[model samples]
Target: MPHIKNALIRYRIIDKALGNTYNPYPSKLDLRHACEMELYGDTNGKHISDSTIEKDLFAMRQEMDAPIKYSKAHKGYYYDNPDFTINEKPLSEDDLTSIQFALSTLSQFKETEMFQNFGFALNKIIDRVNVDSDARKSDADIDQMIQFEKSTAAKGNEFLQPLLSAIQHQYIAYFMYESFVTQVKKQRKVTPLLLKEYNNRWYLICFDSVKEKVITYALDRISDLEIIEQVGEKPSDFKADLFFRHSIGITASAEARPEKIIFSAGNIAAKYINSQPFHESQKIVLDTLEHTKFELFALISEELIRELLSYGGDIIVQEPNSLKDELVKRIKQMKTNYNI
Candidate 1:
């Protein structure tokens, strides 16, 4: 049985050689040599013999209408059939949905126009996936299907080169930044470490030289930026991935450190949290019969508060009096608004 299986696999390899040909398929002995080389590389200087390959070819001739015929010059068999074609069947419904979701996600990058080719390639995949005769739409309709609009007219192309240069060289770029909080006008010089785009907004993760600490400045708030020759050094152990792993958005400040948070979650909320972790430091504390207790280690920024509020009654922050106080205040304000 094993020998027959190996022979079948070898025949499949021969079919592959034929499918890849422009005119005539490779000779039988040549095909076997190619397959042997591919299947078993020069691990111990061992290779399949020519006679064994010829016997395999002879055995294949008795099985099916293999387009192969004998050739004297090549001293082996060659393809005689000219009408051979490899037809790629259409993808399943699951494949189409998966392709659509991928294309939708890719549409987010069209803001920079760098991923336009991906959009085109996604269209081809969508066309192949959707084979229903009555289907009217094509994957090219992704442009209309997805609406990834950036709040600010982000000039990803015009500013990307200079910004990347500033980040890589650690040079300071002068930007006219308008603070959304205080609406303050400040000309600041910062040592760039990373650039992050979140929720359709671009942010620069850098150490403010004057402040001597890390700060996140929104790119949309930047008016005019020019890279300066002056450069500064980042922390020796500073890793962007680790730094932002516990953060939500770019609100993590220099003073922000990992803090332990205990919370109770409903079954639905627990599943949601498990699907996408609240923080890298998050862990399931108690998985009981009714509810779940979760411990989170993350930067307790305004983003965290907002996320908790969005979940409403589904989650309850157990410890950290500061967070509890804030949540209570917000809840009280909500109560006062409704006067209930």
Candidate 2:
């Protein structure tokens, strides 16, 4: 297909010709030069004639809404307006840096509608930056980091889209799921409540109507998701945070109410809980120089235990003797199997 919109062409021109210095509003000569470079690329001695360049520039200025400006000093042209701009709320240097960081992180989402939406917002902000000097400190490394996230976001979207559709349409979604306990290829009918992206992979938080409860189905294990037209209403007052609040994963059923469970963490595990709180009700119960006890108000699930076990000897469940006994029983079963 013909490159009619020419986003790449426009982007390259802005990068090379303007070099962040030329006001997005620029003179005639600059436009001419940019157009030539964009169309032909470093033709050495063979350049577009000045008259043809002027004609092209005039046509572009008349037809397109590109920001172009004329400068008397250099006797050339520049962008009259930025391609896009953003009007952001008043921010400190740190705030601006944080926003820039967020934008960079969010850039990974560029190809998706979400990224494009944010880009539109960012463009308006960039246009409003009245910095006269084009030579802002070069940060290629930071740009690279931003670019990497954008690429990762594109790949992540492959799983997110369908789950999103299922949640929106209120369709019963059928997926081939691997049972975490049984390790069996089981087909399930679920009312997809929300799509959650924790760590890296996408997870479908859904009400398993057949199982008569909610469950978290890993997107990786899901295959052949056919949305059934027969719709069921999501439970009234169904808040995702409340549903998954106490549980570590999607294993918590309505059969269990919220409970406060205390766990002890030594060394790095304590540090982890301090920085990344488990839930809203997480609090430091006991603190010593070597160890810390945390009270987490959440429904204790098998997933929560697995997360605790993954911490090895660093974390110990201090409360809920039922859960502790279950862990102990598992340990004994393992020992018996090993004849130890």
Candidate 3:
């Protein structure tokens, strides 16, 4: 259960002294000096304090559950049981497995820019896990057995920390945002509330005081951000769950409402959709070898249309004439654009 390797080394040194029959009763100074010699060698390096020795003994007894006991006559530490050794208690198999699993899970984010500041701490834990497990299970080893999605140098990830800080500190943030449709940039002042990530893209979901509504803004299109001023109280009316209740991707249109939209997908697209659903509200109405039908209670946003279109001939819109007509109109526009 040693977090750092030095603790393990100190435990071994104490174990050796405690179990040494000839050395019998090594006092506190004897233990500390022995540890310094073993760790720092004959270099006369900074001596470890008596408290350090005391803590090491305490950690051994408490953390490792070592049978350590003090003899009043000997005036030193010794083990109640003579046969116990530090080597016999590395880490339980279950413990090692859990630590390895945690390291593997963290390996997914260790490479991302968002995790760079924590790289040293993460790497130290990884190294400790490797040593404790007695297996050099690097990222490559985990990759061979199980694959994880590759990390990207995703845009707007840099803003995550600052936006989260602003939210925590109750501050208003000012930034210039570029509109995708209008192709125009405009200054926006908003109360920072939340940072959302979807499909590796970052988004700022905040209350727009000027517009008197909650809105989602893409981080990539945002620039020149400044934490403007402190706000007395955040808009209590804005509930994240309610705001994104009918969301599709990052755009939760103010005018849109959640409605049931049913669609059928061919074999290939059905396989993909079954693996990764379109939305949380997506439900399979029917499943078969040829085509599978699905129903989604979600907003009919541009992202929904765009992703559905990505499936091309593999999917058919089966209900809600409004969505079908919109798709038809888009298809016609696409054909006209292609001069087909």
Q: What TM-score, over all chains together, does every model reach?
A: 0.56, 0.51, 0.57
Tens-place lDDT per residue, model 1, 1-340, is: 4355455556656655665433244765557666685567432325566675666667656655566677687565565765542223233343345546655666677556676645765555455444331243554554454444325545432345567778778888776678888998788777788888776677788887777788888776776676798777576767887778778756775556767889998988889988887676788989987789999888788888898888899999988888999999999999999998
> Tens digits of per-residue lDDT for model 3 on 201-271?
88998878778677789998888888866872467666665777777887775566788999999978898
Instruction: List candidate 2 segments past 4 Å from native.
Output: 1-159, 180-186, 228-230, 267-269, 333-340
lDDT of 3 at 230: 80
> What TM-score should be assigned to candidate 3?
0.57
lDDT of 2 by residue, 1-340 (tens): 1232233234334433543341334454555556665567643426555665555545445544345566677675566554432122233344345445545555577668656745765665544331311223442334333322232332223346556767878887777877778888988888899887655567787888887766777786766667777686577767876666666655556567877788889967899878977766889978998999899778777777777777878888867898798778877887899999
> How close is each model in CA RMSD to the real structure?
18.2, 15.9, 17.2
What C-alpha lDDT values do all the predictions have? 0.68, 0.63, 0.79
Q: Is candidate 2 or candidate 3 better by TM-score?
A: 3
Error of 3 at 204 (Å): 0.5
State candidate 2's TM-score: 0.51
Q: Which window of ten consecutive residues has the lowest lDDT sum in model 3?
A: 134-143
Better of 1 and 2 by TM-score: 1
* lDDT agreement of model 2 with the native: 0.63
